[model samples]
Target: MGKIPTTIPRRQLGRRLRDMRQEAGISIQDAARLIERGAGTLQRLEKGEANRIRMLDIQALCQIYDRMDELPGLLELAKVAASKDGEQGLWWNEYSDAIRDDFELYVRLEASASKLTVYQSEIIPGLVQTADYARTLGARYFSDTSSREIEQVVTVRLNRQRIITRRRNPVEVDLLLDENALRRVVGGPKVMAAALRRLADLPANVTIRVLPFSAGFPLGVACGPFVVLDFDRATGEPPTVYVEGYRGNLYYDRAEAVAQYRDTFRTLQAVASSPADSKQMLRRLAREYER
Candidate 1:
């Protein structure tokens, strides 16, 4: 069996192929019939879940859809999709054992996201967590996890931070952290101090705002912690909201749901401290932790 292509580009390409087929007024069954493959196979191809895709199959589909002009781009997408050795992309695949399978999709989306708006009430955002802070949380939460596995978890998180600092196209991160999150010591006073320092020294692309506990019951209070990831508009990938649960993570991409999260974020931003004030508050809190 051929290795499945799971990169974001491949998924985007598959989605584009599906859109083209639909625009040509072709049904999945008809397209599958044209290519002599099962309807499920064609469906998966369009959804980017297929373990493998053939350039010839893509060409045939394009021809059937009368979209010969799209052949070059689709073929190029096929080549890139087929280039993956296995599930490896952006380095997250290496720590698959420590991370949940379902969450990998979120990581993949995050890797390619152009912007991330994160609101956390209890802990530091993963993308910005320091190594000691991450290690402490990992050990506490995954009580049964081995030391090596915990380290691997930390490595994956620290590696993820690169997306924000990358030389080209750094992901813009907008974070609204509840005041309690900073006050709550994670690793210890020293660890908490270091983590706060890290957050304080974030690059220009990363924005942080602290929502004080004094600002009682903002719009996002009931919403809990969630992240909205926005991709490039050209890719046809809509903004996504991620909500984590005890059992699994839930993703919302529908326009209405996505809109609600976006609006809520804006409201929260209004109530949160300005960036300058937030940074000053972080410094003050760090000093408190030092004592």
Candidate 2:
């Protein structure tokens, strides 16, 4: 048996594919044989119960299910699922932290993504947060959580930051911050000041944009916080979108929602400051907050 992803993104993608198949009015047996797998196997995959997916098998299913349009999206999830090595359950899970649930798929997808576009409505994006700043915020928000565990989480987030420029394929990141992130006072003024300096000091490729309260909300704001990750086809040939929320994450392979979010993001981009101006704004906030 293969390992299952303990996170929402992986399962959600599989669920979307299954829904699309049923909507097309295809029977499970036809899909299974077409994908060159057993009926039960196809059924399991559709239910988000499958451990791993074979590439040729997915291609076969895509053809039979009459979803040549969606084959690529399923392929990307296959790549993500393959990278997962089941983690030993962490002690911090006693509080049932939401981030813990996302840890596995978060790493796998980040590793594979060619470009990551993020809109952070509150707090610094984890990729750019300073250790003390992270510790302070994590400690407070996770009030019941012990300092040791919080420290471990801070370490994990900081460690993940190194992926900004990995050797073989340097990941590209475009992070948009709400102005509050720079002014929220997570670790008090001093800690906030240091955090801003760290954000300014990041490597050149990582772009930080601040959406000031003055911008008065862009198209995407109505939907709430979401990160859209772009993975150029590696083994699977289609791009996939991951949307997260408090309840769970949603993966969109359906044409409609994907198109809608893309349009929404484009609207946000239109209202956002240009790259040069964004950097300057971040620098200004850092100085302003310092005083």
Best candidate according to lDDT: 1
| Residue-level lDDT tens digits of model 1 in 20-127 | 888999899989998999999998787666778888998998889889998998888788777765455447767888777767777778877889999988889889
lDDT of 2 at 135: 91
Q: Count clashing residue pairs per candidate.
A: 0, 2
Model 1 residue 160 lDDT? 81
TM-scores for all candidates? Answer: 0.78, 0.69
Residue 83, candidate 1: how far off, in angstroms?
A: 3.7
Q: Model 2, 119-144: lDDT tens per residue?
A: 77777877778899889878876899
**Structure candidate 2, residue pairs in collision:** 35-61, 72-238
Regions of candidate 2 where Cα sits further than 4 Å from its true position: 1-44, 47-99
